[model samples]
Target: MTLSCFDLGERMLSVAEAQRHLAGLVGEPLAIEACPLAELSGRVLAEAVHSPIDVPQNTNAAMDGIALAWPQPVAALALVGRVLAGGRFDRPLAAGEAVTITTGAPLPKGADTVIMQEQLAFPGAGQVQVSRPETVRRGQHVRRAGEDVARGSLALAAGTRLGAAQLGLLASLGLTGARVHRRPRVAIFSSGDEVTAPGAPLSAAGIYDANRYSLRGLLQALGCRVIDLGILPDDRETIIGALRQAAQDADMVITSGGVSVGQADWIKAALAEVGELGFWRIAMRPGRPLACGWLGEGRTPFFGLPGNPVAVMVTFLQFVQPVLRRLMGQPEWQPRRLTALAAEPLASRVGRVDYLRGTYHSDREGRLWVRPTGRQGSGILTSMVLADCLIEVDADRQGVAEGEPVTLQLLNDFS
Candidate 1:
């Protein structure tokens, strides 16, 4: 169903509802690509993998000690041989015999326990003394076969993003590479007559285009192949031509600074003419005006973000990041939001979801606290740079007082 921008004025969506709607719009994962294990970091696995062999593969020693036969009738046993990590005894140990074994060595046959080297006395060559035979237990300090990962058990499921641990697990299963979804190609650009590119002379009324660069950085962090279309003028035909080309070439199109319902805003008109699009006046602060829809015959997802620098970042983090992850085969990836105590008062309207940029800190007792970073204006780019998190004031609440609990969406390591 198509949602007309004109009728959505009074039917603005809450943040949660918008998330659900965008999640529904995501289709299947992009085509799979076989990536080397070394390059699989941050890529989503396209298939479930089962272990072809046991992780340990065989019974091995877990400690550098003496492998014993257990139930020692005497305190002294003759040392038969030394077992290193990759070597084992040629013959099984007879009674009253112990093998000096290092960690990770295969357990010698007939050895039921391992006594730590520190716990035994090495009086002389070929003779080892156990001070306390009662301390030895059968099956103690032994790593059994298939204990870590079974031969046929599922190691990782589809849609699992490969991190350090996941890649290590796959390596343990003897996999040299993995099948992963290809990175989504995202086309990004800034559109405004007043937006100027860096490294060029700017008119008095012009400002360097920062949104495209910032948006590209965010997209790159999410593993997208970014196609920069540069700055577009506010002319309707020029904007439409660029967007159509982007739609044809990229999996997603993202633009900043021409989506608001102002007289100078020509992108909304261009989208309306090109494809099924909707302009939403979402109940959000910093970023209220957003346009989302499909563009061109390929139906590439298009996101028209606000002009303000901070709003561009806020909206992209909240909306675009998740959509790209889902399209790349990551399932139900949600940003972590945690609770923190407010260090100062915060002003908010009851009907809007306010994202106040703030610097968070932990107290001596390990309590998290957040305080606003100067002004909460949308144009203040420094606020976002100086802040580590966004303090979320819910639409249902009026405001927050000092020491009151507030929810914070993590922007960096602080959260």
Candidate 2:
């Protein structure tokens, strides 16, 4: 069946419906590449990684203490030898014998329990004394072999984004590199004669283009390779030509404006002329006119964002971000969300999800509360700067009263 991306007759899609529709069209992940451990952070794994050997490699001491066989009814033990990290005891312990063991040192053979150093004393040369025999616990202060990660077991699964912890695990496994999906190459552009690039003289009524810069940063944060196509004029031929060129080299294409269903919506018309249009409008605040489809031969994904600066940010965060993740080989990833008590009444209308820019804070008592950033006008770019999160009001909610709980979609992946 053919999917229509620019059909003016289709009803406006809801936020969730739009997301689900885009998810299916994103297709398979990009090609795989081997990234070194140092370059792996924020990259998605392409295949499940298995540990070559057991973590810790053997039963080891977790604390600096004396290790001995426990519950054997021993009155005392003679200290046979000492072992530090990276050192091993030469011989096994006989009955009623102990070894001084440091943290991370492999346990001497036949030793099953560890007593804290403070709980033991040297009463005589080569003799150890347990001051608190009753306090000694069996099998204490020992990390068993494969306790953390078993040998030949899965360590990191495919589609997992590597972070500090994951990198540390790979390092612990003595690996220098692993297979990861290549970062998606996204071609971004803005349309409108009034949209002027920075460092260029601003014409009368011209505004500096902020969407391109912001889009670059957001795309980079998601580990995408951004290809800036610069600002295109309102001419249909030029827009269509740039999109066709982008599809040749880019995995996806995004435009900042000219998507709404109006006579001036040139990009929407261009998209329909050169490619398919999945949906052009969504039932949401700030950014209602969002178009998603493919350019040229359905190889390069396209996103037509709202023209308003704030709407560009809102729609990108709520919609485009997830699409990028899917294209980057991430599996069903989602941004951060939490419920907070509304610090004040929130403006909303029934039958539409309101993505109000909000700042959430914790009170002295550690309770989280949220409130809208003043004046959520789509053109006010500063509101997004001052805000840390998007306060999401459900379509069923008419409005919010003070102290009512509301869901917040955090702007940052928040680590």
Candidate 3:
């Protein structure tokens, strides 16, 4: 008896549910490694980082000034000594006397306030006059020790992805190395006999495989260790074999095409034979036939994206990338969204969330405007290349009128 193909429900999994499912499948924790700060970018912190010492190490001047008691009348202050950064003043400062200190220099003993050099009048003869203000507070202009970070305080929590800013913060705390989660291994492939590789001469009916390349590039941008499984023909046996092999070695397996309802599409049948098909046919345009499941005996998470070039890219960014972040132990996995005005009217069929490729730029008034690239067809890969964002139109909204507000998901912001 032949196994029957199941039509997955239109029941779309909430973004949270998708994340939890992927996390459950990728149950194994990544082994942590002590990586140098230079190599820590885009890696997840496996351990909480604590400040070993105070940020300033001591009370220091925030400006170049005379460190002395405030409210002193305009009088000659004997320049008893000078305090340079990294140099200490051992002698105590007396009343009516000022110590010349540069920015970041430690505050001298018995001196709390810092009067800027500009506030003092130089009368020559190694003396400077100060017109002190009334009711000046002690420790003014002083950056106290640990004001920014205290010793033993939590500097960064675990599961935080280290970026350039995070790296700089760790470096400021004298961290030379950090324990970070290993990159998740992802295997990418595309199916369809008509798809041919680029650089190869195309037959009369052949089409170059864009989904594989686009998905691979997106995975790379997400910092995944991608394994290109190459293209597979739409044969059940071959698809099942390739998926099983990929599931054996990869934390996740991603494929494009063969996910929709068609006689030649074999990914669903192949997944059911190897593991389990969880859901498909999400209410999203250009990607409505999205499918997800697990494969292999271990049940590695898998994503079956639509064949259209734009749909493949959009679905991966919206669904697969977040799942990858969860597998890598990142706490905040959602992409940033921004609001922009529609540059022109956008027409769409209702019932499916449409992700229209658009180019966004700020007008002189500092308002963001998004204009759809010509030919919003899903098959047009060039439109995606020319687009910087995906303008999200709701499934129930037929279209967007000109100058209307729309939420856009950035595609090339980091790049």
Judged by whole-model lDDT over C-alpha atoms, candidate 2 comes out at 0.86
For candidate 3, report its TM-score.
Answer: 0.89
How close is every model to the real structure, measured as TM-score? Answer: 0.93, 0.95, 0.89
Scored against the true structure, residue 122 in model 3 reaches a CA lDDT of: 71
Prediction 2 TM-score vs. true: 0.95
Instruction: Residues 1-415, candidate 3: write the lDDT tens digits.
Output: 0011223255664434444555454554567778998888878888899999998788889999789876665468777788999998998888778889999999888888888887777788668786555535766788888998899999999988778888988999998989988888999998999999999889899899888888777777767898998989978999999999999999889999988889999998898899878655566666777778778787788889889888898888878777777677764557789999999999875766788999899989999999998898889888888888898887677899999999899885432
Ranking by TM-score: 2, 1, 3
Q: What tens digits encode model 2's per-residue C-alpha lDDT throughout 46-68?
A: 99999999997989998998988
lDDT (Cα atoms) of all candidates against the true structure: 0.87, 0.86, 0.81
Per-residue CA lDDT of candidate 1, range 163-199, in tens? 7799899999989998999999999989998999999
Most lDDT-accurate candidate: 1
Candidate 1 wrongly placed segments (more than 4 Å): 1-10, 132-140, 412-415
Provide the global lDDT of candidate 1 against the true structure: 0.87
